[model samples]
Target: MPRYLSILTFAAALFCGACQNSHSDSKNQSSPEAGVKPAFVAQRGTPVLDGSGSDDLWEASDWLPINQIWAGTLPKPDDFSGRYKLAWDENNLYILAETTDDVLLDVHPQALEHFWDDDCLVVFLDEDASGGTHEFSYNAFAYHIALDGSVADVAPDSSFRYFNDHCLTRRIARDNVNTWEIAVRIFDGKQYKDEGDNVPMLLKKGKKMGFALAYCDNDHSAERESLVGNVPLPNTQNKQQWLNADVFGTLELR
Candidate 1:
């Protein structure tokens, strides 16, 4: 049998919440309904990730809504609005996100502590899409991408660590609108190493993975005000995605 999350050794850590939201037991075990997963196709394109979606390949896929409120109160229309597009090639997974916010905050300068409250992007990924609890292992990853281009994730040691090289990000903020372009390199969670050299997988057609995108909004407060996700989760009250891969949406390479 394949090891999805090392479940037999499952032990909830002291800090298992995401964006200050705790995990829910029922939602963590929920899978896609009747095995019918929501599939978003990634168009085959190698676009230039220069904080600007100027490449022609960017038009390949339609903009996906980032309107699902996974945690906290829903913001006003002018307070926050966002949409994103996905594209991939043999080298990397490209993401173009456009967010209009009344204010951008990066309160937590330290990447490891309370980074989720810094108004960043959270990327949830499961290499094989085998849904399970990944609160303390590399079976899946919840990457918190900060505004300063800092990336952090929980390591196998159950401690927060920077995985900056995993995702290269660039953003151009003008007025109150921000255009963020990121190039993501996928790694096998089962084989990922903290101190060892790991090569990212080359994307190909027909490949499937568990994936979701979210944003944390904060306006100078100690905690984030809202958490907007891409997928519509069942429990609108709790953030099950705090550490579960089952709450994410599905993505297939085209």
Candidate 2:
């Protein structure tokens, strides 16, 4: 099983809960009676990772070994150049990824309006296998309707069954280095620890936080590179078609 990697790109937006109001008018696109598409559907970005990326940008030694690190099949050693970095602090999580493709250069001029097809990053967190509930997310826009929301085929009109009230604050900034930084801040009901009683128990019982991430450009059929960490994932001994982005010693919590 490939571990997915997540870039925290919405700490501020989550802390503010600003986009929730705008998405209010939007309802599930799939109709139960006739199965109609959504009113407004968006496109996804292309996949650009060829598996040749630098592992040095990560701080692996700091993370706990809940699971073993599994390697995914590389696209081809000499094929293409792709690199990414993962790091964290006591207050925020950071992910820096870069690829050699020029198609990802298209930028979204609007904020909180673009869907998955636009060069975007998705984050999965609070994975709970024992409880039979896993949360999948991308910034504040999430689809809890079905945890089966695979990043492989994310459609803008795809209707999610459950949309959590929680918000994910992120800030995605591009630099001249041809790299982008996705800083995410998770402000779940748990974040209000100062006001909650069970928070301490949740924190001490090894119920901290974890993440999975995937980046895509415009290619809907192209395979995407992903990373997973902290989540008790399934065994990936035979699945070679999908790449695992999750790495040990990669994520941290505040």
Candidate 3:
């Protein structure tokens, strides 16, 4: 089996960003409430910056084998990928994800699939060694989860399925710029997917799981918080040249 590359401390420090702000209250990471069995994974790689340009925290496939990863993508020259930076401080883990597209994003999820063509960010976190899974998927518009087994997306507005009970928060910003970010906390299966053979897959209390990224066919259709940022956003016309996207954050486990 191939060895899993650990993230370097030098790179991880460079990507560190403060999460304190008016929006910080929306997502709180305090571990599973009391008796709740928190889902978790072992601390894998140290936080690091993965992208082109030494100062750029978002690392492109240039350094690592992008194509080698399942559903991963390589960015074209000039345009950039999403920015990802991770950090963990004793009690909680912090992760930030962002992407830049030459073609402005199409912020809407309707029909069978629409946002599938645009860019997106999919995150998975399992704090415990159990077989359960905690997923947070988002497009340029909104975000959703499969807490346990229920699937949520930005399309058709933010709604919940009867599958299971879990916590979810959606944030949309700079959608016109073709950029977006999400803050998540995986505390328990009840807060995520509530039923069925639900078990932690990629993460465990002591074991570790690899983080992944990819740019494939547009398979998203949902409503998003429109045109953010006062600055003029990138044009989404005929700019076939794909942009680069990366994630950054740290993982802290006990």
lDDT tens per residue, model 2, 1-254: 22332223455557346445433422221111112211111112112222222334332322221121122332221221233444444333444444333344223323223333344444444322112122222212222111122222222344332222232222222332234444333445223322234221122122234344433333232332222122223453334212232311112333
Please give the lDDT score at residue 86 for candidate 1.
89
Colliding pairs, model 1:
none
TM-score of each: 0.84, 0.35, 0.35
Worst 10 residues of 2 by lDDT: 37-46
What lDDT score belongs to each candidate, Candidate 1 first?
0.80, 0.30, 0.30
lDDT score for residue 167 of model 1: 92
What is the lDDT, from 0 to 100, of the residue 125 in candidate 3? 37
TM-score of predicted structure 2: 0.35
Model 3 lDDT per residue over 1-254, tens place: 23333345544554453323312532333222222332232232333322112223223212211121122233342233443444333333434444444544434333224333444444433333232222222212112322121223432224432311222223233532322222333443333333344432232334332233333323232422121111111332223211111121112343
Q: Tens digits of per-residue lDDT for model 1 on 96-140? A: 998888989987786488888889998888989997888789888
Q: Count clashing residue pairs in model 1.
A: 0
Q: Report the Cα lDDT for residue 233, model 3.
A: 12
**True-structure lDDT of candidate 3:** 0.30
Off by over 4 Å in 3: 1-69, 78-80, 88-93, 107-117, 129-181, 190-210, 213-254
